[model samples]
Target: MLVFVTGGVRSGKSDFAERRAISLLKENGSNLHYIATNQVYDKEMQERVKRHQQTREKSGANWIVWEQPRKIDELFSHFKKDDVLLLDCVTTLVSNELFSGWETNSEKWKNVVFQFEIEQNLKCLFSQLAGAPWHVVIVSNEVSYDGFASDEGTKVYKRLLGRLHQHIVLLAKEAIMVECGLPCWKKGGIRT
Candidate 1:
């Protein structure tokens, strides 16, 4: 089963996703896996990562964590049947994929190519997960509400993320948007 969870920053989306994953694990007695996509580039980011790790530890569940900022499709073989995999956030994955070796002076066509590559990579990963028996919970940030940015790069990022969210929701059995620590179901019934 595939689930998509999204919300604004600090909207308790991660906490919700974690609780859902733990619930799935308890029900099936499967191995719990966490695919963290954030790269700590500053002190605040480091603290955020640390806090997430601590939260998982405090849950009293054995979680096998994988720090994968890119090439998520490569991890398909490592997961076993009935395993519960939670990808913390897709925003960081998109940022890492979009900006790794980015050329500020590149032409518009180059940006298109970058977006295509990121989309293809995600598609491949999702395809592999769809065929597997694992219960996948994908978490992402909802940033389109801030309105389209004036900068070209920011615009492209927002557009790409919006497209990705739509695609995932279509594929997911459940799609939820969390606000003020409350989950609003957009697709499928609320599991929790």
Candidate 2:
């Protein structure tokens, strides 16, 4: 089953998803895999990553962690069908791809190559997940409220993330939006 979880920044979406994953792992009797998609770019980010790692370690689950900051679609060869993979935060993965593709371009909206890269990479990862016979949980940020981006690159990134969310939500068996540490189920029930 595919589950999609989204919420504002630091809105407890990751914690909710991890708890659901723990229950699913216990019920399904499957191996737990945490696919961390974030990377530390500075000292502050390094500390944040350290804290997250510590939290995961203290969660009292035997989670096999994989750090895949990019090319997530190519990681299917590393696990089995019975593995329960929880990919925490698609926002960082998409941002990393956006930066990598946008760095070589001039105008953000007019860059066809960057657009193609983002579309292809996201689609590749989603399709790979679709074919995998495992319980998958995807976490993303919901930041498209005001519908206004200050810059062209931010605009492009927001639009890309919105589209990615729509696609994944459709592919998911369950969709949830976390607000202030509470989850409002949008598609399926909260039960595992």
Candidate 3:
């Protein structure tokens, strides 16, 4: 099964995802796995990362964590038959790809990424996710709730995330939107 959970910043999305993983593990005896895609480039990020780690620890869940800021497709190789792969924050992963020059769009002024090479990459990634033998949970942030972006780069980034989330929901069995510590199920049931 593929589950997609998304919400605003600090809206209890990650905590909800983590708790769901633990519940799923208890229900099915699946080995829990967590993939963190954010890289700590500053003190604030480092503190956030530390807090996440501490939260996971305090929950007492045995999460086998893997940090992969890019090359997200390669993550499927580590999956197992009875494992539950929880990819926390797809937004960060996409940002890394875009800033590191992996996305491809026709915006001339947008020079960070070129669109000539990402089709096959996205295809392979989706294929891998679909073909995985175990269940998967993906956590992402909702970027379209606020007002219009003031800059071209922010606009492009928001559009990219919106498009990516749409594609992922199509492939997922469940889709949920979290707000203020509550979840609104956009697709599928709560017990899925």
Candidate 4:
């Protein structure tokens, strides 16, 4: 099963997804896996990562954490049937994959090839997850409402993220948007 969760920053989407993953794990007697896509580059990010770690630790679930910021498909072989896997967020994954080789000011930012490549990579990863027997929960940020940034790079990032979110929601069995720590279901029922 593929589930999609999205919300603005500090909107509790990650916490919701983590709870869902743990529930699925307990229900199916499966392994809990956390694929953290955030690349901690500073003190703020480091603290955020620490908090997430602390939360999972307090949950009493043995979560196998994979700090994968790019090339998520590489971890496919490590997962097993019926396991619950939660991908913390897609926004950082896309940013990491998109800017890995190109500078923000480079003309390549305008090229459609980079976007296409990212879309293809994510598609491949999702396809593999769907084919497997595992349950996957994908979390992403809803950045479209963030006031318009006039920069070309920011524009391209937003466009790509929007497209990815649409594609993910379409493939997901359940789609949810978290606002003020409340989950609003956009697709599927509220599974107990």
Candidate 5:
């Protein structure tokens, strides 16, 4: 099953997805693999990464963590049909691609090449999940209502992210938008 969990910053989306994944694994006696997509590039990010790592460590030892800030498709070689893989986000990966200039000159979109790169990467990832046997949970920020970004770069980033959300939500078996610890289903039925 492919589950996409999304919310504004600090809206408990990750917690909710992690709990759901744990329940699924416990019921099926399967392994949990956390594919972390964030990198500690600065003090703030470092602290945030540390805090998240601590939380994961306390959560339990049944999980095997893989820190893949980019190139997530590479991990498919190691995953099994019975495993549960939770990818902590599409946002970070997109940001990385943008800053790294992967979208500067692509034919898919008139915008930056990284824009197409990010979208293509996400589409490929979700497409793989559509055919994979393992359960996949994806966590991402709900940037829709964050207000218009002030600069050109910000505006472009928002456009790409919004498009990415739409693309993934279409492929998601279950799509949720969370707020204040509550989840509102955007599409698909909840798993029984």
Candidate 6:
């Protein structure tokens, strides 16, 4: 099963998803796994990472935590059918890939090519979720709610994120938009 939870930054989306996944895991045993995507690139990010770690630790020490900034396909291979795989957020994954220069910057291209490629990458990722061995809970940021960003990079980031979320929504067994600590399920009949 794939549950895609999306909301604005600091909208309690991650907390909501984590609690949902953990609740399910409690019934099935302590086989919950958190796949963190945030890369601690600066002091603020490091602190944020520590806080998230503390949250998970307080929840349960039985939960398996894996921090992978890139190569999600490789990461999923470690999961089992009984485990719950919770992805903290996909927005950070995009930023990580972008800053890592996986998307080339050509003076000639209008950034459209890179955007399309990223969308394709996301498509491939969701496609891989079909008949997955584990219960997957994906968390993402909903950036489209905010008005258009001014800078070129911000615009491109927003565009790619929207596209990525759209692609995942199509393949997701359960698609939800979190707001004010509440979830609106757009697909499937998951009662959350």
Residue 8, candidate 6: alpha-carbon lDDT = 83
* Cα-based lDDT at residue 166, candidate 2: 91
Looking at candidate 2, what is the lDDT of residue 188?
Answer: 84
Query: By descending TM-score, how would the candidates be arranged?
Result: 4, 1, 2, 3, 5, 6
Candidate 4 per-residue lDDT over residues 68-123, each given as its tens digit: 99999889889888999999889998888777765445555466886787778877
Candidate 6 ranges beyond 4 A from true positions: 27-30, 102-111, 190-192
Error of 3 at 185 (Å): 0.9
lDDT of each: 0.86, 0.84, 0.79, 0.87, 0.80, 0.77
TM-score of 3: 0.87
Error of 6 at 67 (Å): 1.4
Model 2 TM-score is: 0.90
Best by TM-score: 4
**lDDT by residue for model 2 over 22-54, one digit each (tens)?**
878887847899998888779988987787788
Q: Which residue pairs collide, candidate 2?
A: none
- TM-scores of the models, in the order given: 0.92, 0.90, 0.87, 0.93, 0.86, 0.85
lDDT of 6 by residue, 78-97 (tens): 77776787887899887776
Best by lDDT: 4
- Arrange candidates by lDDT, descending: 4, 1, 2, 5, 3, 6
TM-score: model 5 vs. ground truth: 0.86
- Listed per model in order, the count of residue pairs whose N, CA or C atoms clash below 3 Å is 0, 0, 2, 0, 6, 0
Give the per-residue lDDT digits (tens) of candidate 3, residues 1-192: 778899999999998888877877887746899889998889999999999999999998888999998787677667778688888888887777666633454354275445224433554565577567777788999888787999986877787778778888898888888889998889986742
- List clashing residue pairs in candidate 4: none
Better candidate number, 4 or 6, judged by TM-score: 4
